[model samples]
Target: MRRIAVLLPLLAIGVLAGCGGSSSSTAKPVVKVSGAFGQPPTIKIPAEKAGGSLTVKTLIHGTGPVLQRTDAFVGNYAIYIWSGTSHRLAQSSFTAHRPTLFAGQLLPGLETALIGQKMGSRVLAVIPPKDGFGTSGNPQAGVKPTDTLVFVVDMMKDFKANASATGTAESNGGKGLPTVTAVNGAAPTIKMPTSKPPATLVTRTLIKGSGPAVTKGQMVVAQYVGAIWSTGKVFDASWNRHQPFNFTIGATPTQVIAGWDKGLLGQTVGSRVMLVVPPADGYGKSGSPQAGIKGTDTLVFVVDVLGAFST
Candidate 1:
């Protein structure tokens, strides 16, 4: 067993009692695991389950860097629900098509379970409704409001953001798309596109990098600033938060705009690129007003590709 320098709240308090009025001592080893890492485990559930809090048990220990709560830790997971009798495997992220999940991206309970665990570690956890799909369980996954969820997760890698946006600074003519300028390693400021938005995608690599080129189906860790082409109003920026934003490019149930898929497909990591996305490739007819974009607004983005992970 490897030593864990950082421990989550669950590890310290152990199993909590709740759900029904029964005490947790009645549900020892709420989630039973009898399988090797990287493969589906034989999970067994107790007749009595926990509900008040989360129960996490480390199955395989890892002797690597301890992960932070907000780190974009790439992982694979399989989730199941305790259906009255047996544990029915619901969803599995253990395939080659697993996505890297972050804080605001996963269930609050799962985050608590993964935090403090080092990279390459595997753990099993039982989550109650309070920390899971609340009173109204996710009907899509056949999860009942009162169902207890179990997960087998494998923390794979810890990704780090790049420092300065490095790459070959190129020009896109004097008045074509948009103009981007950065100083002293600061975030690039854009002078929004003056001409009408192009019908096709307009991608310009402001900086050419020496790192690996981003490929389709790879998750990109990056810092970016987005704006509306109509008014040049900055919609969102990752640099302002001093944190990097990440998403799978060209992935199933795409997490980012189509502009990113087309613009960043062949770009190199560590390079800053600008994308001019028309309505067809953006939020489309139903624009994101919360993002300050109109139905017909053309979106612009200055993305700093920090890293790419696949597997």
Candidate 2:
């Protein structure tokens, strides 16, 4: 068995709070596996006669309350790549505490597994190629497209509605612009007027792309550029790097500040947006060490929509 380093320290501990529940001595039987790529998993449970095959597996069991769509969750999990003869390409662990069913937070298979699970439940899910990293595979993940992925997940706490109630009226503070138009069952389109320059020079559309419409839980990929609205000075941009930063949207309140969330919500694929964020919305009080963004700086971004995934 090839053992990759399991970086547990990188895992989010706070997310695993309610996962340490009592374990049931009785073991659930693992029977024949039936299913093809691009299809849901199937497991036969002997405990209940009416039990149908489970699309995913709950390896570690928890004894906490069940979860609902309105609830949010925090968790720690390990992902491993599985070869035919028990060899694993790589493994890593991380923490995620966010609205469980929200789009753009998790992989397709893991998101599907989490939908009906409750707090304190431990899940061990076997993900096939199509459901995991697709054809190109995750080179950094060390798993090939042909590899099967296994995830051991521990659901910590499920916070009920209004759990982390931000007193503000909108989800984030009422900072972001209101929806100008809604994309109704069509590919998102941006109509930038050629004749006139946008009212603001610095603008961005943080998330973009087409797959499934982004909700709140799944991960989002985007391209971004930052500049000053006044002088058009380019401050920061991901265009040169040619790689989008991968962050699970809404998973960590601290990963991104309030302004970003407010800016991104309800944005559809292929949307282009401009933001003129005040110092309070950009960098408040303390500027970033590396970026040289000042405490009093009002930032602007030009964001391009790339793609979204919901599993």
After TM-score superposition, the amount by which residue 57's alpha carbon in candidate 2 deviates from its true location, in angstroms, is 23
lDDT of 1 by residue, 1-311 (tens): 00112222222112222223211222354566787766656677676644455778788998878987555656667777875555666666555465444423456566667778987788887777766666766665577787777888877766543245666666632377778877735677888656787877788877777889888888777888888888888878876765577677776667677778878898898788888888888878888877777879888888888778774
| Candidate 2 residue runs with Cα over 4 Å from true position | 1-34, 38-213
Clashing pairs in 1: 167-207, 167-208, 168-207, 168-208
Each candidate's number of clashing pairs is: 4, 27
User: Residue 86 error for model 1, in Å?
Assistant: 2.1
Each model's lDDT comes to 0.68, 0.45
lDDT of 2 by residue, 138-221 (tens): 655465556655556667655443221111121111133322222322222222222323333233443343433456755445
